[model samples]
Every structure is written in structure tokens, then in C-alpha cells.
Target: MAQDSGAPEPDDKLHDECGVFGVWAPGRDVARMTYFALRALQHRGQESAGIAVGDGKTVLVRKDLGLVTQVFSDADLAAMPGHVACGHCRYGTAGAKGWEAAQPHLSTINNVIIALAHNGTLVNFDDLRRELIDMAIPFRSNTDSEVAAKLIGYFTQRGHRLRTGIAHTMRMIEGGYAMVLVRENALYAFRDPHGIRPLVLGRLGDGGWVVASETCALDISGATFVREIEPGEIIRISDDGLRSERGCRPLTPANCIFEHVYFSRPDSVKDGSSFYLMRHRMGARLAQEAPVEADLVISVPDSGTPAAEGFAQESGIPFGTGLIKNRYVARTFIQPTPELRQMGVRLKLNALPDVVRGKRLVMVDDSVVRGTTSLQIVRMLKEAGATEVHVRSASPMVTWPCFYGIDTANQDQLIAANMDLEQIRSRLEADSVAFLSTEGLFACVPPNGYCTACFTGAYPVQIPRSFYEEKFLPGYEPNNLAPASKTSQMTLVQAEELLGQEG
Candidate 1:
């Protein structure tokens, strides 16, 4: 919610769960490395920080619900002295507050002490949770990482080594998930086969290697950027040396397109595409899909610029700074008052009276979460300028809430999921409005290589149908949790147990 660039705050807020950082080193400063990496990832999640260090058999963990500096003291990391370690900074897949749900979870079942920090959501969480519960596995947190750890334990119990256990871990569930796992002497890291989220490898000069949720973390840790962990690819770092293995059951690559538009840091490269450049392409594609004869292709600013340039290029319209953004705005815009969002729009963006005195202007934006901002911005453009105003969206309508870590689980809030494009355009009341066609949007990225689940209804992984629409409060039981009261019902839950919360 924080606007790092001091731009005007949009009516709707963007959502993300958090980022994780881990390191495997011999006589190396893993703790310091984690600290810097988490700092880099602070934008991913800001609610919690945790670190777990390992010395072969025994592991030391310090975790709490607070910012990295608030939760960890120099003494905390000093106490965790180890050769290999994993750490987490949490935002919440859906955990709004329950800070008790902070991660780097360690469940000591048998002699194996497994600690894991997860970055994305697991779609099969409820199904897997029920399956484990029926078998009497007790669960501790609401996080999908518990399911990840339990999955890891199942494979390790079957005598699979770190690599095989990790490879097998991908076979059980679905959705976007990247995890860093720590054991006695080795550190294992893996990404879901679809590669819906991102995980990267970095190497220190001392030969110590790191696995991070984003390249920004590697930069913060002063680690050299290595290649990305490919979708379904597994990497292991130990005394023997770093090795790669094929993991997840092969499937079409579906990296989350939203990552480039919003979630990831602009500097990081994901799946071989520059995040900023990808946005530029998306904007251009949007222009092609929804063209308008206008004086300038003004972007919403910040996140909307790259796409605006693309739109301008394709439309043959000169790209102009239609709106000037204020740079002093707070990083987060949790408006204290009811009309703060509207005020945020005004304070953040200013129409160029010189450029728009009588010009037909085209506006480009990333996504319209709710119609409030779209309506508001459209009105502002009409007031500022010329004859006609056209609105072009870079992505298709978002009809579904992402249960996998994105906080927009409240279905009632999503406008496109319920209304038709015509309805939305009418609601905004613009001269002309068009969304990027589904085909056009897909063509903007690699073929069939990103999670369009939010735009399309085809969920790549199996999740409890109820979960997407369920009223979930972290650490609360079903009796205490209320239903949304309007979502279509599917299967009912049977009292169940959990295996473990692993990845």
C-alpha cells in the first residue's frame, strides 16, 4: 500500500503475501546476509521477520511478529550461529493480522528438524489439510507452509534425501509457491513447476550461496546474481557443492503476470524477462487491443508508465506526461479519513493544463481492481481537458480473488468478477473504454507461461472451492469464522488433521 515513488494513491490497494531469504555457507555470515536480504524484501511483506540457523543436527530459531529490525536484535542473530540458515519476512497470504502466524516454522517430528519459509500461496491447501487431518496430523498455523513442511516430512520419512524429498514435494499440490528449507547440514530450495512466483540464486565471493524471493534481496545481501531457479527445477547447496535437479511434474509454465505489473521489484529479472520491460510490452498490447485517437498516452504514473509508452508506440500517439505525480506522498496510503482515497487521487496526480486544454486524451493503467478509481480518474480527465477521454486497461478484468497469498480474497469487492465489460464501461461513463483482450494479454507475455487464474477461472491447482470465497481469519477456528453468505457452495468439511506445514 506504500507508494515508494510518492505517486497518488489509487482507490484500490494492491496485495502480496511476503518474501523469503535463505543462505548456505561454510564459516560465512548467514545472519548478516539474511538481515540485508530481508531488508531488500521488506516491500514484499512488512509484518513479521524470522530466522532459523542450523549447525548440522541442532537448529536455533528466532521469530516474532514485527518488522525485521523490531523482531530481531543483533543478539538474536548472534545466538543463531550456524553454517546454513533460512529466514522469512511475512505479509500474509490471507492472514490480515494474527501475528502469531509469523513463519520460519519448525516442527520437530522424529530426529529431523525441518524449518521452512514460504513466499507464495498453495491452492491445494484446504484439500491437503483435510487429507492430512483425516490421517491425524495436527496443524499449527493457517499458512500453506505448514502443508509444505508436512509434504517435505512425508518424503523425508520415506528415506528420501534432501534433493529427492524436495523433488517429490512438488508432486502433491498446486498453485504459486517458492520455498527455502533447512535441515541438519544442507539447504534446499525449490519453485512450483508453473513458476507462478519467483525465486533466485546468488553466490557470495566466499563460495556461500543464497536463495531469495527477489533479486533485490541478493543486491541487499551483496550476493552475485546467479540464474533463476527454473519452473520445476530444484537446486541443492551443501558441502559437496551446488547441484540442480528436475522437480515438479512438468506442466505448462504459468508465471504470474501480475508479478511484472506490480508484485516484483522493477530491477529484478524473472523468467528471463525484465519486469519493467514486460510492463512496457503489456501497455503496447493494451493499446493495440483498445486503441483510441488521442493527443497523448498518459499513464497512471509509476506502475502505469511502461505500459503507457508501449500503448503510445503502438497507437502512433505521442506519449506525453498527461499527469504529474507528487513524489512526497507516504509509501503507504492507509487514508485516515473516508474520502482519503479521493484526496489521494487529487494529491497524487495533476492534469497538465497546457497539454490537455482541449485535447482528446488516452489514459493507461495496470488493472482496475474496483471501479472507484477508474470512475474517479475518468471524471478528473474530463474536468481537466478536452473533448473526449478514453480509458485503456493493460490487463484483462480481474474476476477472481487470489487465495494464494494475494489479500483480495473478499469476492464482493471485485467488480469485474461479477460485472460484464460493458457494465464496467458504462459504470465508468467514459467516451470509450476497452480492456486488453484475453488473447492480446497472453501474447504480451510468453505463450502459456503465467498464472492468469485471477483473470481466467481455470485454477491450475486443486484448492477447496470454498476457500476462495471463505471468510478466513488467521488462527481462528471455523465456528468463529463467518462465511461471505453469497458464494456458491461446494463440498463440506469433515473434521480433519494435518501432516506438517513444510514448504
Candidate 2:
């Protein structure tokens, strides 16, 4: 939905692209299982929700522009009985918005049908789309996800197995992605070579299997977490049992570090540690690095609560709630009147005067994006009688844009990209402002190769020159940490020859 001309600006934070889930279980209500899983993964996206089920004969899909609960009624789930299914909830980063762009994108290859849900941006999709269009392939949406589904279908129809088609397609797409696909009789899951986006494998009751973008989805669906889907790996689950294949050669691991700082739910576990623990550690580290004298440490709200608690514990300050969020205020189509528009952040959050009055406050938030929301929040705290409001970010300053699944602004709109620490503090009108150091952020998470591009301006994948030219300002340049590996971008002829050799 387009924002009204006079609507209040959105919160200054990065948005993740989407969440994907797949399940393969006979005798289970696969549709309902997917529905619940999508609910758990809802935080990853809110623009649209969809589910596709393969009932042993044909793939059936239902999708629309709304939250998961808004899109799927109990009756809708009951209507889509199947043994295998895939679901998607999307906040589109690489496509136009509308019902057409809602995913679990469906396509046909000969007599076979498949539905796919994807969770990242494809940096080279524009070129690939043009290539496919030149080949007379039809397209329903401008999303890279549709390109993927059709690309897989195109390869499959040319006398290749579905898994091989998927493998070949994986070799062609460039960017951070985790995808879940469902055909009439099986479920497939795959990830990009760098593992820049997350996908987890899980075991359902004795005979079932599940894959999702996060462990929280698996938890809600009564699935036990097994392990992460390896980078460049393809997982196929069918009646014959589970199969895993190396769809492409794995490159240096570059998992998105933001997952620990903000994206994943605090309760979600990664590398044997809960995100909550990692964020808490980040808070402690932030406190050590940027200590301040304040009577109370308060969080921006739900996302910042864990870090705020740790900050309080480490600094020996009392932790209290100075701001209360209106839980029911989600994205709305209804435009607020001019008076309400001026209220801005107040529509979603309100200051607790009884808690903050006359106290010096240290307010911790997960991150600072454009700084507009932070400025309003600081003003609100002061208006509520706080003597001072110190803003602390648990994550490092986001100085660069993300071309992966995250919906970050161009460099010009990112406050950190344009301002130094002192300038940012002045801009936000906060008594003080501090961000966690990049090195400190890395210390809090598990020891694994991570994508710190947003903090360091070092990209793991080679962005298309066109994309780079379009996204970066004139004076800015990016550091290509690792370009696309040779084997990752296979030619059609090479892919065909390899498939023939396997045959």
C-alpha cells in the first residue's frame, strides 16, 4: 500500500525481505502447520503472506497483501489439504508491491507444477529477467522470485530433473537467498553459496521434515531443530526419505551479522546460542565502551528490552520501562488526519510519565537508521519530564546500504553515512549518543564468517556495476570483499553439459 502524502514517516530501521518455510509430512495438516510457522516468522515481513501446498497431484496456492493472520483464515487452511507445503511472508525489497508480488510464486513446467518462496534479493535478476523474457518466458510479477520459479521450470522442462533444474538455477542467481519450493510430491530447500541469508533444517514427528528461515518457525510448528542448511546445499524431502546435494560449491561463509543484533527474534537460536544472549552481550559491551551516569536505563521497546537489561546490569543502573508501545498499531491503510500525522511516533509509542518523570534516562535501541525516529523518541522522553535522554545503539552504526535481503536506504539517507558521532548526537538532539563498535559486535556472536557489509562497506558478493552505480552516491565506493567465485556463475551450456554427464 502506498503511504498517504501527509502520512507520518516510518520508523528509521532496516527491513528484512521475507521469511520462508516448508514442510513434508503425510497425514499432517500441512497447510495449518505452514500457517502457524508463518506466524512465528511474521516479524521478518508484513507486506504479504502466502502458502502453497502440493497434495500429491497438483500444487495449490493462496496469497494476498496482508499479515499472515489477515491473509489466512481457518477455512482457508482447511481448504488446502496436502502432504507437502511451502509458505512465504514478504516485505519485498526487490519488487513492486501488490497481490501479484506476494510470494510462494507458482509456475508450470510441462505437466509439472511448483511453488517457490524466496527470502533475499538477487543482485543480477534484472539481467536474468531480460534474458528469460528474450527466450519468450512469460512473467506474472517483477519479483526476482518469479524469475527463479520460471527459471527452474524452464530448465526442468528441458528434460532435466527438478532437483537438477534447481541446482542449475542456484548456479545462475547471484545474491543472498534462502528458498523453499514445493512440487506435487516433494519439498525442496536451498541457500546461496555464502549463506548470507539463513535457512534451518528441522525434524518433525518420526516421519516428517521441515525447513525454515529461522528456528522460531520450527519451534512453533512442533519441529525439533536439526541443523542449518549448508551454504550452497539443496535439501529434498520425499517419501523415499531426505536427500542432500551440493547445488554449488560453498564459498567463504558470510552470514548476515544483523540477524543477531536485530532481525531474528530474541528467542531464536543460532550456532547454539539464543539471539537474546548475543544481544545481551552486545549491550554489556556497549556499556563498557560508552558508559554514562544516568538514574535509569530504559529500552525503546520490545526489540531493545534485552539489551537494555544487560546495559543496566553491567552499569549498575536500574532497568525500567519508560516507553510503552501500542502493540495493536501495525501497518494500516487508513491515513491519519493532519493533526494525528503531527503526532507521528506517538501513534505507536507513548512515554510513561510516572516512570520517567524527573529522572535521567539512558535509552537503548537495537540500532539507529536514519535517526528521525530516535530524535522523536528522545523528544518524547523529555516531554514526559525526563531530565536527560542518552541514546545508545546495541549494534554498530549502519554506514552502508544492504543489497541482500535487507531493505536499507541508499547511502544518502543513512544518517551514519553522512554524519560523524557528534553530528548524529546533535541531529537527534539527544544529551548523548553512542553506537557499539564493529569489533565489539563481532565478539558477541559465534565465531563464523559474517557479512559485515552494512557496517564496513565490504560486500561479500560482487554487485552488478549497474546496481552499484544506481545505489551509491557519487563520492562513495564499496569494498568487494569477495567477488562471485568462478564456479558460482555457470553458463547454460556448461550446466547442460554437466547434467548430461550426470545422466
Which candidate comes out best when scored by lDDT? 2
Each model's lDDT comes to: 0.72, 0.90
Where is model 1 poorest over a 10-residue stretch in terms of lDDT? 487-496
User: What is the lDDT, from 0 to 100, of the residue 70 in candidate 1?
Assistant: 77
* Candidate 1 structure quality by residue, lDDT tens digits, 317-432: 99888788886543342434545544547766777778776888888888778777777777777788657778888878776666656777665677776667788888887777
Q: Candidate 2, 483: how far from true, in Å?
A: 2.4
**Residue-level lDDT for 459 in candidate 1:** 55
TM-scores of all candidate predictions against the true structure: 0.78, 0.97
On TM-score, the candidate that comes out on top is 2
Give me the runs in candidate 2 sitting further than 4 Å from their true place: 1-8, 487-503
**Per-candidate RMSD vs. true structure?**
7.5, 2.0
Clashes of 2: 0
Q: Over 4 Å off in model 1, which ranges?
A: 1-14, 55-57, 66-80, 93-96, 130-137, 158-168, 246-248, 316-359, 379-388, 408-412, 463-503
